[model samples]
Target: MGETFYIKNMVCNRCIASVLDIFGKEDYTVESVELGKVSATAGKKTNKSALASKLKEIGFELIDNETETLVEQIKVKLISKIKSGETEHLFQSLAEEFGKTETALSKLFSKSEGMTLEKYTINLKIEKVKEYIQLGQLNFSEIAYSLNYKNSSHLARQFKTSTGMSMTEYKNLKSWNRKTLDKIV
Candidate 1:
């Protein structure tokens, strides 16, 4: 049976590919790799210390604590939700998905992450907004609608609060700054 290793800061498909490459280089038999987790059989040639160091060098962490693993899982799920535009009843949905009460999950997230879950979600949403703006495909109203904001003005307010600039100002910038999903915090 393959062992599962929880990872920190794996936020996208590229991260999965990077993990797969690392495992291959380490000569492990990888069963599967996904956001925040990998299932693999360690071969004789596999040096776990080297693997962990490689991951760390590339801005990832091998999560050994059960609580830290759970927190990373929560982060991965939240990122997926934001990407899929499922922003309604977030706490309730997450609670049901994790089979835990909202309060319990919130407390756990805050304790592990040093930020409230709500703040994390907002940061994710703001990053998504920056992406859409950079793409120049959607108007402000459309972007707001896609992200499930009540209205464009509400999105505008939140965007300003999060980014320290209005959407128009961001668009007019010579260089657009965007955060990688894993670096949202």
Candidate 2:
């Protein structure tokens, strides 16, 4: 049997690809790496700590235990909330399901990542909104409503606050930057 290590900020498939690439370079056959755990055998010629160091250098850190798992779960849920409106039940509103209060989650998240849960959630939402805008499938008003925003103007205001650019301007940019963010495990 191999070992499993949880990871933070691993919210997308690209993140998984990047992690596997690193392990492959070191001759480690990664068995599996989901949002919650990385299953891998101790390679004959690889140092797990050294591999960790390399991951850290590239902004990937190995995680362990329940607290870490819960945190990542929260982040993934928040990301999905923004992306596909998948949270029919808990849309940036994990308070009722998690047993603990959002205040407590926010405290733990802030201590771990130096940013509040709300801030992280909002940033992710903005990123997804940018994605929607770039794809040009949904209009600004529709996008705002889909994202659970009160109104198009409110969404525009919040977006401007975070990104310093209006939706109109961001969508109009000839050279736009599409973010290939982390995956949902």
Candidate 3:
């Protein structure tokens, strides 16, 4: 049977590609790679220690412990939902999606990650807003609605609070202040 590994800091498509390349370079036969998981078969010559070190060098982590694996799973699920414009029913659907009660998942996430899941979700949303603003393809209202914000004002407040700059100021800045999706946490 192939082994499945949970990965940390795998919050975007680029992260997936990076992980696949890392495995490929090491000549591991990757069965599948997804948001925060990779299934692979290690040959007899495979060196797991070197693999872990390489992954860490590029800001990705291979999670083998149970608690960390669960935490990564939660993060992947939340990020996927947010990016897919499914923020409308996040709280109601999370428990069912993760096969645990909301309270249980919340407690576990908080204890392991040292932050509330709500806080993490907001950070994810704010990062997406930054991306949209940087793209210059949509206005604040469209971004707000797409990200399920109640209104532009609310989005503005959160964006300012998170990044210490208003959205307009952020968009007008000479240098970009956006963080990679994996770095949000």
Estimate the TM-score of every prediction: 0.97, 0.77, 0.92
| Cα error, candidate 2, residue 105 (Å) | 0.6
107-162 per-residue lDDT for model 2 (tens digits): 87888777887777677778788888888999999998887777899989999998
lDDT of 1 by residue, 1-185 (tens): 98899999999999999989998999899898889999999999999889999999999999999789888998999999989989889889999998999999989999988999889999999999999999999999999999999999999999999989999999899599988988876
Native-referenced Cα lDDT, model 2: 0.75
All candidates in order of TM-score, best leading = 1, 3, 2
Which residue pairs in candidate 3 collide?
A: none
Tell me model 3's lDDT, rounded to 2 decimals.
0.88
TM-score of 1: 0.97
* Candidate 3 structure quality by residue, lDDT tens digits, 24-67: 77778999989889999887777888889989999999898998
Ranking by lDDT: 1, 3, 2
Q: Given candidate 2, what's the lDDT at residue 157? A: 95
Better of 2 and 3 by TM-score: 3
